[model samples]
Target: MSTPKTTVHYVEDKINSWQTRSPFIILFLASLVGVATGLIGSLFQIGIAHIISWRMGIADSEFSNIYIKCLVIFLITAAMGAFSYYLVKKYAPESGGSGIPEVEGALLDLRPVRWKRVLPVKFFGGLTALGSGMVLGREGPTVQMGSSLGKMLADTTKIKNKESQHTLIATGAGAGITTAFNAPLGGILFVIEEMRGEFSYTKSSIKAVFVGCISACIVYQLIIGSSPILNIGTYISVPLNSIWIYIFLGIFVGVIGALSNFLILSTRKFLDLFYQKKEYFFVLTGALLAGFFGLLTIFLPDITGGGFLIIPNVIDELYSFYPLLILFSLRLIATVICFGSGAPGGIFSPTIALGAILGVLFGICARTIFPEYDIHLGTCAILGMAGLFAASIRAPLTGIVIVIEMTSSYILILPLILTCVTATFIAQTLGSTSLYSEILNNTLDKLGIQRK
Candidate 1:
């Protein structure tokens, strides 16, 4: 028989051994979350693409009566929108809107994850909403669904540790962004910069984020060929003397971004006043909006969808100054209508498209004024992309890195930094709230939960 002291010593050693190995175990689980997120996100992307193709193919098929074709397309899109809105109303309301706010709330332990409901609802609802050619991006659904997966894994495995849960969720979120844009650095920076308030920057957590991002990127590349999301061709470096031009562009974007945020918030509030009493009306309104956009898509495809198809064309100077301005104005209206109506989509891509349009307009005017500087409109478009994102999101590093990764134009780093920094400063000086923060507060207010 062993002495009492020996027994005590043996138990202590066992406890120490398990403690030492627990971090590795958590990390392994996080990696699994990353892999799962990547697979699901890629599938989501493929599903959206397939649906869009099918819709377009049907529309383009030879039809004896053009009116029949329009009616069929409108009804189909309206039905899709109705089903998507129904999912949000019936299943998981948290899955509605750009899910970044929900994820942020979850990080702070202020909101319930409801992963079982959210995962399915977001996946299918996003497919329907995006498939109907709404002005939305997949990043929102992917990030929300990814984070839900992490929470599901944790709950299923019965992990009670708070830090581990937070780490895993953050990992999944970062991986989601990585797979969405195929930009690993942007994913990592999003976690570090965008979720700074809720994320705990522990050594273990940081390592877990890195592993998750890398794994997610690898899976994404394997499925969706490795190419920059935006294949805009390279451009000559901006002349040193032209740096001032970017500063001006940044200032202009900063004002527009602030105004955009105000309008989005106001529109949401205005719409809510009309629909808060009858939830079904909100859903039907969304359907009507979707149908209207369907009509618009047939007439003017440029202003609908996630705005990706129109971006490259805009950068190539396909539109003159007045046309660019008109396109921007129409898109601004579409973005506010789609996003303000609480459609399960993201504003990120729409903002990017608007910024690109504004930049091209500015560039066209600049080139006309300063004929000697050899101004490249494409360069201005790229800068505007990052500048507006930086100002609106208030995550300049993430915005800059994402634009660089998506465009594969690291040579514009100086201008990107200058533009993003100036935009951020001006936006802050103007007292504009960060987009996600405003959304989170709105959500919390609705829940009757005071911020901790």
Candidate 2:
């Protein structure tokens, strides 16, 4: 026993002693990347939460006059939106969108990863944009910022090898996602499954991603607590006899997903035409957009923000069929506008919220028609999330894993799989492509930067 322990120690020491971008050094850098990414991601979440709570509190508060309250809300959100839009437009133009495409382009050497400009712009811009009652997610800024940190660290450590730099950058991206959803496995799978063509698969690269993901999750939990990202809560298992119902649910969700993608792309083109007319007007449009959403937060709170709070309410069956349908339509429109306007935010959270709404809608109808069978509405909401995401993003495995890890519905893995696969198949059959891939191609076309 003593000899075995000594040999193990010897091997560890020898590995640690290796330098110059060796496996040990690379992995060590990856952990550092994770720690830093987690710290920034936690801070971003905290700040956004504070901003939203403060804004919404006043919106819901009883005031002497409603006009004054509306004006105050509008002004506050407009200021935040203006600030965010100005930062991205003036400092880092590339920080305008999800930033995932930019990172992917950097990995393919088709785009520049200017960390110095991106870090501050994406961080502050995303914080303000997401907090200003915009229907946006935090994952976009965190993922981009995480990858920026990877590059920053590589440059600081004088790691000139391109492949090693790629490893660290990819690690940071994974770690950032892990921090966002508190899902380490989901983060790693995002890089592996979603970025399959870009990420280099090697024993060391996979190990680095694992190390980064674990470290990021540990640091995030240390600061934010180890809680599930969504509040749907654990639901009971679904009956096998009712499994066929999920396939139809998936088909519905896939149609919605594909429609969402088309709307976003078309919206961007339409908005770009406006920007061509006058750039400052385009920036001011962000402020006006934020102001409108802020007003809605007071009146129609259902469609404001990233839909995190509303998801639980929908899952608990708070709305009737007509109300739910209206909410879903408005939210889908809001999500597309916010993201397509080139706001520094993610579509992930809003997309999940839409799925939950669809799920609950389907559940209500199903239970009414099939009163004999036990239909779990909450379970449908969960499957809606995974299915819609898989369909739109074209990454079924990542969507399934992410929903599983975020919701802790491990017992429903089979259901999740069936829903995601069916959803992706339907989306593809309907002529829908991966959302990010098309966006990246469009950007490259505009810039005349051909992919290498």
Which candidate comes out best when scored by TM-score? 1
- Report the lDDT of model 1 for residue 336: 85
Per-candidate RMSD, Å: 2.7, 4.1
lDDT of 2 at 398: 84
Best by lDDT: 2
lDDT of 2 by residue, 278-328 (tens): 879767988998899989888888888888888888887789899999999
Pairing residues by index, what is the TM-score of model 1? 0.95
Per-residue lDDT of 59-79 in model 1, one digit per residue for the tens?
887889999988988998999
Stretches > 4 Å off in candidate 1: 1-22
Name every residue pair that clashes in candidate 1. Answer: none
Q: lDDT of each prediction vs. the true structure? A: 0.89, 0.90
Least accurate 10 contiguous residues by lDDT in model 2: 13-22
The Cα error of candidate 1 at residue 291, in Å, is: 1.1
What shift in Å separates residue 173 of candidate 1 from its native position after superposition? 1.0
